[model samples]
Target chain A: MNDFVYKWRNPIFGSVSVVLFFLGWEALLTWAIPLNPFIMSKPSLIFEGLWLEMQSGQLWSDLLISGQPFIFGFGAAIVVGIFVGTMMGWRARVGYALDPLLTALYASPLVAIAPLVIIFFGVGVSGKAILIFVLCVFPFVFNTYAGVKSVDRLLVNVVRSLGGNERDIYLKVIVPSVLPFIIAGARYAIGRALVGILVGEFFAATAGIGYRIAWFSDMFELSRMFGYILVMMVVAVLFTEGIRWAERAAFPWRVGM
Target chain B: MNDTTSTAVSPVPASAAPVRDEGLGEITRRTFWEANERHALGIGFIVFVLLLWEVIPHILTLSRGMDLFFTTPTQVAMTLYNMFASGEIWPAFKFSAVAFSVGLGLSIVAALPLGVIIGRSHTMNAMLDPFITAFNATPRLVFLPIILVWFGIGMWSVVVVVFIGAVFPLLINTYAGVRNADRLLINVVRSFGASEWQINKLVILPNSMPFIIAGLRLAIGRAILGIVVAEFFGGSSEGIGVMMNDAAGKFQVDIVFAGLVIFMALSLVMVGGVKVLEARLSRWRPENVKSF
Candidate 1:
């Protein structure tokens, strides 16, 4: 019995806690307080609303709309950020020259520039994509730069002393060392990318999950709004977990690094 | 984020020395330039960009249209000056300041104790881990709609947003710090007949200082973003974000730029302050480990 308890501890406790929380929340709304559904929604009601929305295909369409810019922007960020970060990292002068500007950009709330982005790119997919790009790029840039900087001097020297040329050094030493940092940066970028898509859609987009969220809120469809929020939460969890799984698969030895 | 902090402050490495022989005066000049090279290059690059930003639009005849959407640094500066001179920015600034302080204060108060509890307790950690992970993973903005519904479109709603944005990072980091506290020191305290409370106060808290400070650094950025995005979404007509939003709608691009500049400055000052505190607090350690 003790062995079984220990083996199943995490799942058992996690589920019980989650179930009890939802039950308590439902009971509090239903009996203890009896608040209006329009003001505060219950979990069952949220699930029901979500089911209806899913059946109507609205949720799928919204996901598709939101996913486009997220993919484009995130993909572009990975390419450009890695290139720029590599250049900055490999060349000391390049890093010095660009350090101040990059730091300022990284430190600031990039979302505040959403309006300006919309103005230049227009209220379209391109604008939202650009916003996500700006939001997601810095983590990649900085992390990759740090990774490059952190490469072992001894390893590089070993490569050079063994008749290895620049390409050989890069392939054998630098790329392998920096791959983990790039993955770590991607993990960070996922959250920022979500924020970018939301803010972009909020600012000007005509379609997308963010637009649906705003529309539901404005119309006071509280249950549906909660439903969409749950979808967002699930999406966030899935994306994060997926990346973690990839990281583990790619670098099994560096599990906690 | 933690990685960037160390890299940002580390001194830049000087380039390889020129091998060719030269005059003594020329060599001295070259050495001086090399010593100050990073700062000079950084400042010079910024100035060049600003000049280009000021000139390119006019040269391309895009300035006329640009004024409607993009503004020059000079225009942005003038707008900032006029806003302050006319006392126009104070009310918005005051509102945001109050919300920021209150929300961040509440986050610290709530997270620190709860984090310590969860970190120290196996049962509590097991039960709460899933919930914490879920909330932390979800963008805090997703809560804004429900928050606005519950708190209405005002300071409280904005405060709640900021609190949510700032709290998770602090809580998670604090928990990590406590869990990763020096177990050897705790054992030493136990051997000395210290009670649980004494152990925590004497060893755990002090050891976790760096982690808590790193958490605060992360929280400040999230909190600032929360302030602007919350105000933007909430339609509160009395914060910097609201002011910027209003300016955008009216095509007052300069005002928007000015507001963004202020936000950037606030972020830099607050983050820089926290970095200084972190450095001071961790001075005793031989090497500061990056924690997030």
Candidate 2:
């Protein structure tokens, strides 16, 4: 019983702190603001708004809209990133050749250029997806390329000495060595991709979580906007945790995991 | 990413001539070129992009009498030049730079101590794990409206947004640095009867400098991101974002592009400046680890 209590003490305390924070927030909203309750609704009111939005299917639709671009962009990042990164890793000359452009693209703030993308692609899913792609792909590719380059030279030389062909050298020597970097990169990319989606929705789109939050903000529906922000936070947390889970599953050999 | 191979290689050039049957001078030069050549693609891409930007609008105008969708590089340059000449860009730049500095400063102050404290305590780490996860993962832009409600749509609200956004990276990095400090070294310091403050100052600070600096780099980028988002939502009267908002409203594609170019350039310069500083620090740092 003592051990159980000790183990759970911090979690309990943390939870209580969080609960108290919300309670305090509610108290401030109510008593501190003697006049306009609707302007800054209480925590209870925010919860009720969340429940209302959920019941109306508005929250679900908003989630789906926000989620679509994230899914598309993330998928594109993994596929294209892996392909290009692997190629760049295996082919030194090619990697060297493309290095400068990738660096510029990697350094460029794609969010700032989000408007240009909207101009070219229109204010739709395409623009959002492109923004996400440009933002997320760089880290993935860079990590993968680094992983490939950092592969044990001794192992490669051994394979070569054993008369291993390029295909054998790549499959047996390079891919496994670089897998961890790829996974790590992908893990980082997930958060970036989400940011991209949010940024896109903020600027260009008429739908998605970003759009909903902005819409609520514009209307000055403080409580509902707060509710949507919470929802977005939940989504981001879940997405990040899912990525970490995937990384642990795929790269069990990773020391920390 | 260029290693200090030259300094290490120069002395060996004369001595290694007969040892490897090839002069070390040749190897060093090859390494230098190989390092430098990595930048070729970036140069080529810039040229290619410039060419496209220059050619595309002219072709569109000639073929369809429409350059609405496609703006020329010349037009973008002209817009930037006009903004520069008129000194219209200064206020926005000043606002952003000031906001960025303040938020970044606040984040460093709050995060560094908190992170160090968390790093020092396992109980605190386990306790705040989920909370920190949620806090860090939360898209701060979503809070812009609420923050505006609380702080009002001014520098304070924008600064709050930037603070929230930038704090996570510094905290994470500081925690990482402290956690990763060599156990043996800590023990050695402790054996000398060092106080907590002494250990932190002499041992922990030096060991974690790289990670702390790395976190600062990430924080700066996040700071820029948060500033832009805050400006977009929180009704900021000036800054690049206001220009962006104005340009977007009027469908001034060239002006919008110009704003974007300025922003990207600013970000690149800031990030690149930090990268250079990091490189210099790493070189001067006692540890001889290779950097990427």
Residue A48: error of model 2 in Å? 2.8
Instruction: Give per-residue CA lDDT, model 1, range A1-257, as digits (tens).
Output: 99999988988898899999999999998889977867888998999999999999989999999999999999999999998898778777778888898889899998998988888888888999999999999999999888888877767767889999989888998888899999999988999999998998887877788888888888989889889988999999898888889999998988865
For candidate 2, the per-residue lDDT at B252 reads 85
Candidate 2 residue-wise lDDT, B5-49, digit = tens: 121112234655567745555577676556666576657667887
| A162: Cα error in model 2, Å | 6.6
Cα RMSDs of all predictions?
A: 4.6, 4.7
**TM-scores for every candidate against the unseen true structure:** 0.92, 0.86
lDDT of 1 at A149: 80
List the lowest-lDDT window of 10 residues for candidate 2 chain A.
Answer: A33-42
What does candidate 2's lDDT look like per residue over A14-122, in tens digits? 7776787789888886777663643576788789989999999999998888777777887898889888877776666667667767765676555776666766677
- TM-score of chain B, candidates 1 onward in order: 0.87, 0.85
- Top candidate on DockQ is 1
Candidate 2 C-alpha error for residue B235, in Å? 3.5
Q: What number of clashing residue pairs does each candidate have, in the order they appear?
A: 0, 3
Off by over 4 Å in 1: A163-167, B1-30, B63-67, B288-292
